[model samples]
Target chain A: MTTELSLVADIGGTNTRLALSAAGVVLHDTVRRFQNEGRQLNDILDEYLAECCPDTKPHSACFALAGPISGDTGRMTNLAWTIHAPEIATRTSANRCILINDLQAQGYALPALAPDQLTPVLSAERDIRAPRLVVGLGTGYNAAFVLPIESGVLVPAAEAGHASLPAHTADGRKVVDWLLANLGQAQVEDALSGTGFAHIHAALHGEKATPPALLARCEDGEAKALKTLEVAIELLGGVVGDLALIFLPRGGIYLTGGFGQALTPWLRQPHLQTVFHDAFAAKGKISAIMQDFALSVIGDDFAALEGCALRVAQN
Target chain B: MTTELSLVADIGGTNTRLALSAAGVVLHDTVRRFQNEGRQLNDILDEYLAECCPDTKPHSACFALAGPISGDTGRMTNLAWTIHAPEIATRTSANRCILINDLQAQGYALPALAPDQLTPVLSAERDIRAPRLVVGLGTGYNAAFVLPIESGVLVPAAEAGHASLPAHTADGRKVVDWLLANLGQAQVEDALSGTGFAHIHAALHGEKATPPALLARCEDGEAKALKTLEVAIELLGGVVGDLALIFLPRGGIYLTGGFGQALTPWLRQPHLQTVFHDAFAAKGKISAIMQDFALSVIGDDFAALEGCALRVAQN
Candidate 1:
């Protein structure tokens, strides 16, 4: 039997990564990246087809976009592009096409991700039958609850990062106050994303420092940068623990995105662990529930692409 | 054809409310209240059957308990009784038996509740296809997300009240600090439930007062009592907005329980509306989403009994 290829793309604000998948596995050699520089989605698709896979045509396609999807159409909130799946299907000569929200795609990716692609941050036993959580913290923050339903699993997306930020300690309160004064709001994403790290650094150092620079300085033994990271990680842990209580994801909490990857090294810190457990122990059995979760960071960058492939199989 | 009856009970920490339902409608007259005074759930069932409906034997039974239920048994967190559904079914001469968490019963009650059973709090238009939320704020606090799945709807329960509390204002922070010092941590339930109201009254008045007395004083133009209610409502609005962003419950947030009913009179207060809208307006479409939701308070006391009969029908 011959392999049938399907097209998949994980479209974000700045970049759109497209790939070909056969039998739910993304083809490593068929991967391509296209900058989203004010160009229409159709134009990008046309260029990709013409240059990347000159002769072969995919039978189906799934575009996981960074926007709110309404029926067959989607408009990227961060980028100036609108996508309609039917239009893409007609243009690409494909039998079927689908559009899913980015966070939903991330949720779909969880089941398909391999063990090697994951790094256990806070190791603990997991209840395989229970729901799991996927949290994205890069340029922005979002979460998805992967629920097991009768027909199949349902991934309900969450825009929790836009919710209010919580402050636990005195210094944490000051940071929250600073965020309210500077950003006019203290949403969790305001303190938990890439730019959020810069804001925290600015709040501490009285000047902005890039997230990477701050991390490097912290690694190089700079007390100020180290303190910023400590506070940031503690806040992240606190928020994650709070969300854990909300969903009761006994399967685990998986952290994704570049910022999450950066925090992988700090997961074992006593401050982070203490904050997470303390957040739950404040209540009743929630502390025991917290102990049941296995925390991990998605090490693979292609997980969302794999998720897009999974969507194609579903269709 | 004669309608078949099902025995249902909403077992709380202090009381067990038993009733009979036929074809999804609860028989109000058959309802019986039994105090749960360190007795087994089977003993209560026997007493309820002997007193309430001596001649009629129900086909099935569903027990909605205020505790964590596993497989066939449940142990009440607030009381000493351990309940086994299979044994109860055998003793009651019922063919089938099931157990559901009290909050899950509240979730099932949403679709069965009539308009008169609900008091509209926020009268905005709603998107029926989107998910709805059921928030319980009585002796304890919890929430459930009623999501529409492929086979049917799934009401995934949330222990949100146990999550970390958010404080956006100085007075809110003071409440947080007071809770942290007194309770060792500040969970949302610590400031949102009936006991939470008493705690807030104590924090503000330098002495504790019953929730009923505090509300009466607030209505009677007592300055301290009024201030406490204002802060509590603002905090409640803030947390509700946060949950809204998480679920985007366009079907709206339905507040339930005795405390929630008490707050219905204050729903139109500018302080509550301003705080709720401001929480969402800080972001993009969340404010619009908030506007789309039609908030209401569930007023039916027999909702769980009706929900139990619905469960029997599904089985």
Candidate 2:
């Protein structure tokens, strides 16, 4: 007798990862990555199924997309792809299909991730029943609030990166003014994303540099590069702190995405760590309560796929 | 045979309003108000019970407090009263009791409010199935996000008032700088609450004036007073817009509390209304999406009591 498999995929800007799971456990060996290039998502999925399981019709399918999902449809942020649940179900010959935001997928995977896959930024007692928050910092920024319900968890989508950056100190205001003048709008994503790092560097030094080049300069103890990192870290801390108050994520905050992972090492440095904690905990009377929230980084690349599998299983 | 009634109360700083409900409907005739006058919450509850339901034991009880709630315990923000749910349950002879923030109560009361009770600030399409937000601007500032679940609506507590103020324009930053210099922190409450009105008045004109006094001056065509009102409304709009992005409350954004009510007339003024809307929809790329959120003022005085009754009935 053959076991019924469920198909899950994570669709990003340049790559798409496809995997199969039985009962909710991902078949790690069956996972494969394919370049999006300029082909449609349906074509990629057809190729993936043909190569992996030609004769087997999956029981269910779920796709986690790096963009907004409205009803049963989703549009990719970086690529020219529009995903419809009904189309995917028809293409995969699956019983049911669903689409969710990538950040939400990260939120659902939080409960299933092992300790070795997460690195703690701040250690605190976590209330298992409380809500968790997943913050994504990549080509673009967004967040998802993971609410634990009796049946399962509910991950609500948020467009926080498009909101105005929170400015406290005079220096912060100066950066905000610079962003307003240069970018025409001072949004959180303008200063906290991968390209945001470059913007901050440009704002301070009036020179263009990629995030990698700036990171290398910081490693060499360059004062300007170090200041850029400090500004970005402090801004991130302030934004995350504001989010914590809004969401009350006592289950802890998990940072994900390429930019977030890249900043993990810099976030661990003694001086930058202090800057982050201070900005995060500087909410006047509620500063003490803010300290109760633990922070961590999700290092698993397949977490979103796992999240998609878990979502399919829950159905 | 005596009918089993549910005891519900809205405990504010200066006054405590108590009422009895039956079958999820609040008995309007049983509603009574008593001045706290340095009295404990238990004492007020005892007197209310003695006067309203002398010969009967309540089946359940719920209190809506003007403060934070941790588990079943709550402390009044502007009054020295601590409420413990177990104590209230025992005193009222109720099977169980729950404590929730007043903003949360407003959130719960949204569905129960009549059309006449809500005056629209910004008329737009509302998705009833989507989340709603209640923002309180009275003695203190806070918000509650009302998520529609299968069982009932879940109103999550938020301390968004303590978050840093979002400033975009140079003039707004100047006001923020003033708040940072004089108030030691530039929080949302520093420029959006009842006292914050006076702070803005003082910041612009370097004069001490009450919120009411400022309003009267604005009516009398005082430029500084009008400017103060403009600043407050713009700040409120910017903050609410940021919140809309974060919560994605497509259901609606409800403004409650005394200060919010006072600002309703001012928000209706043509020029000030323009100021408010412009500041609110100023979010760059996602500015158009902000227009979809319907803004309204909750004018019901007994909404919190009704919310308490609803909570008891849900139990």
Candidate 3:
């Protein structure tokens, strides 16, 4: 069961974060963030294991990937990393290994999240029993809804952000078309992610810039950068509004990751609220009831990891 | 629980569908459909019991309602009838009395649905374990998603159709606004229900008319009703598209009732697909994966009643 020690790792494109813990709940001695540019994850894991636990072999390994999980292997969406479970388990000699879509793993952690952990963005009576909608606005945009089941004792999560971000307005249409023409990436994530900043920047000002540059410019009150983020945030709100209507997560709608912190402050912002509220208002009373649920962003970097442990705990 | 026969009735505005099932599964002998336009439901039940099972004093009763269910009593959204649960339970001497939003009951039935019972509108390898989304386009529009919890389930039902029906285009905006002003009902359900026909008819002809009359005209290939249904259907598609993005129902999306049937045969029809698909396609891969979940209109008229029975069985 790996009760003594379990390996919990979150592998993104540029940085691979690994920590050894007891059931992925409480961190033990091994927490390290390393760049994956030079070595494969197994080589990294092997080096870490021999250095950290020379005599003992862990029984269970749970991983969260920053990409879509196909079978037992997942290729990192943003990095040149290809991960397969069997190879890693065979090499690591771990008894059990499972890889879950990061968003799903994040969702699994919703139940265990301390109430204090959530900074309420929308203050409704946080009914712990209602379905909770969890979304991640991270390196790449994605979302998951953790819905209460069986009389509110359990919650199942899902990837919801990839669901289209159709432009419902002239401005939205402009943004979408701009992304298509400039970014040339296929989906909403292309425009919703950090990379989306470059596309948005180029669309608004006729030249591309990285997310950091865009954020820096916006912080410095650059007109073009602020305009780009303004539109992007509105679009994000509209999509979140659409999801709230679809899931009716009475428990609440949660925005996770650093991106959420960067964006959620714009929660009550007029442009974003208009798009968010109007999207559901088109559905009728569900819009009215949306006021019944809380909206917030979970500001934890290790949410997915915590969720991975939480998911395993369920099993 | 009572071993004696209990009634599980599904009441709509027109016909009352009743099932005298032991648990939640329907028993052939207990299926009863009674026309209730001229009489009260209590009267109808009394008569049915007299003719069908005079000696049986039922134990408890549950009903699936087509209108919003908040308080104890109920009134049919499209009919002039009152259903007081406690009053009925007391009179009928049924030991238990309960009412559920029809869509919530439908959500419960998804895990138990047979393949043959569902006709695929779109083919997707559904994650059966994932949360399943259920939508009903009946007299009033609503939706619910059944979230699979640790071992139990949560049925978060929503009156989704009324939330907001944001117009996606100039044409959509014009049609929706015109219908709203002319129909004197701006709510999504007002312009998008059976009543929506009259609104569409008025929009097409610049005057209001009855739905039945409009349908009759359309039956003879009248362009007015056909055109109106097209606009209404387009709006309906847009609403569904919004839902597709909101829930990310990768498990599968089930559409129930006559309106869904009328639309299903038309998902492939011209502008309809664009109106619906574009809404979901707004995001990209989520749109691609959504195609994996088959969209279907349940063929069985008895689905909700069967679903109610299935709900009892699960318990």
Best by DockQ: 2
C-alpha lDDT of candidate 1 relative to the true structure: 0.81
* Best by the lDDT measure: 2
Local accuracy of candidate 3 as per-residue lDDT tens digits, B1-315: 555566677888788888776765677677888898788888888877786667776677777877766457765677887788887688667776677777877776776677887766656677766666777776666778766654444576566665435554555566656745654334456656666657656665677788767767756778767777677766665566555655556678888766666566556556656555555444444445556555777767777776666555444
Off by over 4 Å in 2: A1-4, B1-4
List the candidates ranked by lDDT, beginning with the highest. 2, 1, 3
In the range A35-78, model 3's lDDT, one tens digit per residue, is: 89978898889888887768987666778888877668887877
Per-prediction tally of clashes: 0, 0, 25
TM-score, one value per model: 0.92, 0.97, 0.81
Tell me the TM-score of chain B in each candidate.
0.91, 0.97, 0.84
lDDT of 2 at A95: 89
Residue pairs clashing in model 1 are none
Model 1 stretches astray by more than 4 angstroms? A1-6, A22-29, A50-60, A93-96, A269-285, B1-5, B21-30, B50-59, B93-96, B269-286
| Pairwise DockQ winner, candidates 1 and 3 | 1
Give the alpha carbon lDDT tens digit for every residue of A128-147 in model 1.
Answer: 77888998888888888888
Candidate maximizing TM-score: 2
Residue B303 CA displacement from its true place in model 1, Å: 1.3
